[model samples]
Target: MDLDAEFKLDDDLCYLNHAAVAPWPLRSMQAVERFARENAMRGAAHYPRWMEVENTLRENLARLINAPSPRDIALVKSTSEALSFVAYGLHWEPGDEIVISDQEFPSNRIVWESLADQGVTVRVVSLDGDDCEDDLIDAFNNNTRLLAISSVQYGTGLRMNLDKLGAACKAAKVLFCVDAIQSLGALPLDVEKSQIDFTMADGHKWLLGPEGLGVFYVRPALRESLKLHEFGWHMIANRGDYRQTTWQVAPDATRFECGSPNTMGAHAFQASTELLLEIGIDKVEALVLNRVELLERELNKIQGIEILSSRDRQRQSGILTFRVAHQDSQALYRDLMSRNVICASRGGGARFSPHCYTPDAVIHTAVERLAECIS
Candidate 1:
């Protein structure tokens, strides 16, 4: 597929902030427009077709995450909502502990912290400084019930060794959950291989879709462990039978989707997911890594700069963060934005996250623009 033609971004803007939000592919845009037109013209007459799209989305999500079954995927409004479901749904005993990385985005941190009201201890594991893995592992104790960490740290782009962490969590009998918002689309994720009990990611960032739609994956055996926190007709097994009084919540992951679905978002994201699948995840990862390496190499050539992200491939993903020696980070960010060099303020510096489809010219332009701003 012609990714450049598919996106059709403006020539003046160098969009390097796919980590924040991405421009939709042409197919996704077309899908959304068609859905809107159908809604306007035919109303709900073809609602069943829309439902098929939603199911297709679930299947694609399952494939993307390598979940054992599509029944383990739940369509949610956002990653925060999915995290909240896991946070509040579990019955925590007093003195029970949850371990998480100190560098987590607020969404991952705050949800676990909220459990303090129930006497649950929230342990913040520092992934910075010395011995990151040991520090996190040391935090686990007899009372540790869960270890929640992002597959890729949002700001610094430090990719965790999920397989190793999963093995440790399993040995300790603690539930392992991954916040995959930053890693899902840029890298391949395997729930079974990683032994992830739960995972969630919003489609807007790496998936190249829009906001207000996310994929939630819950392991089949663990599905029964989480208490149902939300309820609606759609969550019931007898959802189609409007007159049926006796109803039972779905036994699978569908129980987490407790209300009307986001059909529009589903339609757009399904198209987006299809495009990614067509390209293959391994190729996507290689392309993303190549761009990140190029960005890092170019950034290193500039004087008075510090690379904040990991240089090691095992610890790196799509994000490449850096800071100028004497210039204020925010000022640099503003200068880049004004010059149409799209980036983000993150990791106490500027974050330039380019995807597989990001043109090499855009990367060069971003570097030159940052140099100009600093000079």
Candidate 2:
């Protein structure tokens, strides 16, 4: 596929904020427009077809993450909703412990922290040491009920070794949950191989889709362990059989989705995921990493610029965060935005996250603009 034809970014603007909300691809936009037109013209006349798109989306997400089956996937409004499902669904005893890293995003942090009322202790481990994985794994004890961590730290762009953490969790008999918003589309993720009990990611970020739709993956065996907190017709096993009075909860991840599906979001994200699959995630990872490398190299040459993100290749991700020495990060962020360099101010630095489709010219131009702005 000709990627240039797919991404129609403006010439004057350089988008380097895929870690935040990403601009939708052409196909996703087209899909949304088509869905809108159909809704306006026919008014639910094509509802069945929309459900088909939703199912296809689940399959695409399953394949993207190498999930065992589409049955393991649930379409949710956001990553927060999915996390809440696991958070409230599980039976937490007083004094039970949950292990998480200190660098987690608010969505990942707040959800776990909110369980304090139930006497559940949230252990926040620092990932600043040489042996970060060991630091996290060592935090687990007999009381540790689960370990929740991001696949990549959002602000620092530090990619965690999920395999190591997953293995440690498995050995410790601890449930593993991953907030994969940062790495899901830019990198390959295997739930089964990594032994992840639960995982969730929003579509608006690296997936290059619209907001209000995300994926939640729950391992098959542990599906029933989570008590159902929400109930509706959609979550019933006999969903189509409205006449059936005796309805059982869905045998799959759909049990988490207690209401109507986001048909429009499903259409948009399905197109986006299809684009990512067509390009191949391996190729996407390579392209994104190459861009990150280029940004890192260019930033390194400029004086007074301190790269905040990890330099280690294994820890590096699509995010490259840095700061100009002796400068306020927010001020620099504003200056960059003024220059049409779309990035973010995070972790005490300016964060630039380029996607696989980001052009070389954009990276070079953004770097040159940074140099000029600081000079």
Candidate 3:
């Protein structure tokens, strides 16, 4: 497949900010166009077909994370909403501690911290030094109820050893929640293999879809244990039987999805994920890692440049963060944007995150522009 054609970004621009909002693929745009056209002409007359598409999207998501079944997936509004579902769903007692990394994105950190009024303690562990996994697991104690962390640290692109941590969570009998927004599409994630209890991700970043739609995966055994805060007709077991005044909650993850679905976003996200599966996650991961490696190599050639992300290749994700000596990171970010080298300022440096479909020439040109800014 012509991967570059999928993006077809402007020739003058070097778009490398997949860590932020990503540009949609041509296929996704076409899918959205078809969905809009159908809505304009037929309205919900073809609602059944739209439902089929939504179901397919759910299956695609289940495959993306190797979910046990499509029934385990819930269509959510955003990562924060999913995190909230988990944070408040569980019954917490005073003095219960939640373990988290110091480098978590606010979505993963704030939800736990917000429980302060209930006397839940949020233990922030630093992911520094050689044995980051040991640091986190070592912090676990009898009072530790759950551990919430990002699969990949947002700022430094640090890829955690999920297997090790999952084992620890299992042995400790603590709940495991993963904020997968940064790593979902760029790498392969198996909820089963990792023994993850809960995981959520928004499709707008590396997934190459729009905002306002995400996926929440809950383990089957714990489904009923999580008390529901949101409720609607759609969440009823007999959803079609509106005349029946009595209702029971749906016996699957759909219990979390209490209202109408974002059919348009589902169409777009489905197309994007279909493209990724066709390309295969393992292949996509190899391609993504290759791009990060290329960025590190090229940036190292620039005098006085410092790679802010972890130098360990095993810990690197699709993101490559760096800084130039004596240059203000924000100043460089604004300058790069002005020149159309799209990226973000993160962790006291500018972050360039390219998807697997990003062209090598774009990567080279992006680094070249950053070098020019420093010089």
Score every model by TM-score: 0.98, 0.99, 0.99
Off by over 4 Å in 2: none
lDDT value, residue 295 of candidate 2: 96
Q: Which ranges in model 1 have alpha carbons more than 4 Å from their true place?
A: 129-131
lDDT of 3 by residue, 1-375 (tens): 888678777899999899999999999999999999989998999999998988999999999999999989999999999999999999999999999999999889999999999999999999986899999999999999998989998897999999899999999999999999999999999999999999999999988888999999999999888999999988879798989988899998899999999999999999999999999999999999999999999999999989889988789899888888888889999999999999999977999899998888998898888878887
**In candidate 2, where is summed lDDT lowest over 10 consecutive residues?**
1-10
RMSD of each: 0.9, 0.8, 0.7
The digit string of per-residue lDDT tens for model 1 on 1-375 reads 687777789998899998899999999999999999999999999999999998888899899999988888998888999999999988999999999998999999999999888999999878985567767878999999999999999898999989888988999999998999999988999988989999999999999888999999888888888899789988989689999988998887879988888899999999999989988888999999999999999998899999999999889999988999888999999999999999999999999999999999989988998889987
Whole-model alpha-carbon lDDT for candidate 2: 0.94
| TM-score of structure candidate 1 | 0.98
**How many residue pairs clash per model?**
0, 0, 0
At residue 50, give the lDDT of candidate 2.
Answer: 95
Report lDDT (Cα) of residue 352, candidate 1.
90
